[model samples]
Every structure is written in C-alpha cells, then in structure tokens.
Target: MGSDYSKDNCVHKPPMDERNLQGLKDYLINYNLPDGHEGYINILLYGMVAAGKTSIINTFFSALDPDGRTVTCVPTGMDPNSLTLELKTYKLAKLKFWDTAGWNAMLKSHVKPKELLRMILEGRIPIGTNLQNFKPTFPEEYPVIPGNAIHGVAFIFDMTTMDNISGNIMLRFQELQTIAAQICGHRVVIGTKFEKLGINEKNHAWIYEYKPLQQKFEQLSASTGLNKQCMFVVSNQWNGEHITMIKRILALYALENMIRNIDRSLKMTA
Candidate 1:
C-alpha cells in the first residue's frame, strides 16, 4: 500500500534538487494513507504508553501466534513502556502491520530516535532480518529497510480516558499530524479501549458511557478532516463482534484507497 519499491524506480530515476529532495523526503518520512497495494496494507501502530497498543495486536493476530511470545522481550513485560527496541511485523489477510513502540520509548535508550527515523526515511537498513533475535539500538546499527515502505500509521488512543478534555491531547494530536504530514502525508487515528465504552450483552461490562467521547471524536474529526478515517469503540476482547466490524472497515479502507493506487500504477496507459 505504498510507492513501488522496484530497484528500477529507485535507480535511474531523475535526481531532485534540494527543495524537491526535501519534499520527497517529507513524503517518505510521515505517516501515509494506504494508497497502492492490493494484497498488502503496511501499517504501523502508534499510541501513548499503556494505551493498549500491543493488546490490540494480540487480539487481532493472536490466532497466528497464540502465546505472543515474540514481543515478550521488547522492553516491558507484556508491554514496551518506552522503546520499540525490537521490530515485529505481522501479516493478516492482505495487510501487514508493523507494531512500533510509541516514539516515547526512545527516551530511555542511548539511541536517538530521530537518527533511526532518518535511516528509515533513507531506506538503509536491510530488509527481512530474523525478527526473533534482531535488536534495534542505534540508527546505523538497526536492521531496517532502505527507503520508506510504510503506507499507513495507526494512532491508537485510550477511549476510556477523559484526556480528551485536556488541551494537551489536541496539541499532541496536531504535532503528530504535522510530523506525519511531513513524513508520509497522512495518518489515521484509532480510538482503543472501547471495551470500557458502552457495553453489550455479548461483552457487556463497560464502566463508562462513550457518548461524550464520541462527541469529542466528532470534533476531532471535523478539525482534522479525518471523520471517515477514524475508528471508534474498538474492543479487542469482544466476542469477535466489534473486532470483526473494525477489521472489515480497515480492510475496506485499505482496499478502496491504497489498492486503488497500485492498480493505477499497474494499469496500461492508453
């Protein structure tokens, strides 16, 4: 769900001047909307710590690897509180999700996140290393792909928290959007912890009503123009009901937008 990475497209392509190069660099670095693949939607999960980012991953792809043993060593036990010291990729249906520990994780490590991000933008890291043992510490040292391949970024938030009332959430969201715009030109916000939202007979034990939260989200969407892109009330533990709904929505999102680009690129121009 991104630009074609064919060696020919990278090589032999005309070089850009500094401005154009910077523009391309911005496009390569930010969060992207899925736009050009049929069989795959490359997504990165990002959110504040303790927001249940990994939990969603566990819930969706648990069938593939039951114990979720792979991410156990990342940093925190059952969670990576700070850094994504390790990179793990999972494939489901036609989409691939690259679960990135929130950018905050870079704080504890000696490594600079910006440098690591820059390397990803430039596409210097080797692709397809064994994720089971690969440890990412420094920018030059981490095993990552050369050039940016990420097509989408999923920003997960805890819907149960009233943090939306604080101005900080808006500020942070704007900053993240700006960064994503600079890097990949687009980003998607995902509201998680919906299990705590209005519950149901199948999975009905929620603590709070999410009507207020939905109102806040509506405001957020209007401000960001991400109304259609937003995913609300996601509960990973549901009886495959809400989860299935979200999956279908995400699949349609990727298929309609990202896959369309791939088809266009592959089409024979008359």
Candidate 2:
C-alpha cells in the first residue's frame, strides 16, 4: 500500500533536437497523486451466473485505459474432476477488480456438505483439516473469506430474470444478503443487462429501463431491511449517451466508496 502520487523530480534534462524540444515543451503538464496516498482500490465483484459481472469489470477497465488495454474472461465448466483453476483480474487507475465465480450449484457439490457438517459437529473440519479443499468446488470459485481488504462488493443481478418470476423472488435476495453479510457487510445491489428491457424514461438509464423489477427489488429490500445497502443499476453496454450515464452512476456508487475509504485511512493516520 504505497502512494503512486509524487512530484516528478527527474534531473536528466535530455538534450533533444529542435523538433523534439518543441514537442516536449507542449507536452509538459502537471499531474500527481495527493500526498500520503497509496493509490489502489480493491473491489470485489459478486453475482449470479451470466449476470454481467465480468462485463462491468471490463467496461470499467476499458474506460480507464485510454490505450484500450484488454481484459480477458475465461470460462470454466462445472466438471467435478477438473484440475486447473483460473482467476481473472482487470486492473485500472488505482483500482483492481477481483471477479469471483458467480453462484451456480453444479460444482458446489464437490464439497460434500453433509460430510463437512459431520466434521463440524465432530470438530474435525477445524482440526488440521484443509479448509480450502472443503470450499464449494465450483468453476472459478474460491472461498468467501480469501481477502480481508475488500472495500466493497457490487452484488450484480439480472433484473429481467428477477422480474420474470413473481413468486419466490425474495428467496434470491435473502440468499444474496446472507452471503454478503457473511463475507462483509459492504454490499451494493446492481441490476445489469438492461439493454433487453425497453427504455422510455429519463436519459435511458437502466434505473428507468427496469421500473417493474426495480420496484420489486425495492420492496424486497424494504421488507428485508436491506434497502440502505442498495446502490445503482447499470447497463454498461448501452449506446454512447446511456453508457456515459451508467459510468457516472457506477463511479458515484462503486468508485466513490473506495475513495471515501482512502480518505478515512488518511484521517485515521493523521
């Protein structure tokens, strides 16, 4: 945790040709990170399968990379005897994203929960038994408590699917909240894949695009006492204007929270 913010004190004044000297003079501009800053934000992304979690990460990375830095999302099947496990990360200015596996039950069976429960009652799971191996063995999935420095978690959900099922919708919400609370209480619910929904509201934002689902989620959140933790709804694949709006919303919700954490760190040190 070191601040990349610093004033350049480069002493080697290169003797450039006339053309290069003019170019250098024009390119000189002041840019720096604030004093006593360790410039990095750790964001943990959680969501269900195909909920556009990876796409949100990709969008943020692409937005930060003016040079079009590429990020990859490698798919893994839910095979029981798979050997290789791959983790993906998308890095940007002062931000590093850890996109964990979405919740799909196919690979989770590898854990043998009944045996683990027996071990817990017998006090064996904690007694010199490897807990990592006992984790819900899903493709691209890791145990929830891997990192302690997770500042915030963007809990992405597909609004369209959530809306399709009228009854038992709150079940997923409860599950999501439980998982988030188990990991850390910093959870923000985001609705992704808004392009599939029609848009006729203000500025074509996904917030307006999925009004029915949004209201359902709000009602569920209120009943569950989790409305306060809810943040923004985003559709990063929207057209130019909508894309800008979504980016701004995500930044305000996700990125700004990280910034506030950094500020808190500075204040505590002071």
lDDT of 1 by residue, 5-62 (tens): 1232121122223443333323322323344423444566666556666666654443
lDDT of each: 0.45, 0.46
TM-score, cand. 1: 0.54
> What lDDT would candidate 1 get against the real structure?
0.45
Backbone clash count, each prediction separately: 14, 2
TM-scores of all predicted structures: 0.54, 0.55
- Measured on C-alpha atoms, candidate 2 has an lDDT of 0.46
Q: Give candidate 1's error at residue 88 in angstroms.
A: 1.6
After superposition, the stretches of candidate 2 with alpha carbons farther than 4 Å from their true spots are 1-39, 65-85, 112-148, 164-176, 182-185, 200-202, 205-210, 220-224, 239-253, 258-270
lDDT of 2 by residue, 95-200 (tens): 5566544544313534533333222222222223343345644413433332224445676777678555334445644655564455442556667765566544
Candidate 2 residue 58 C-alpha distance from true site, Å:
1.2
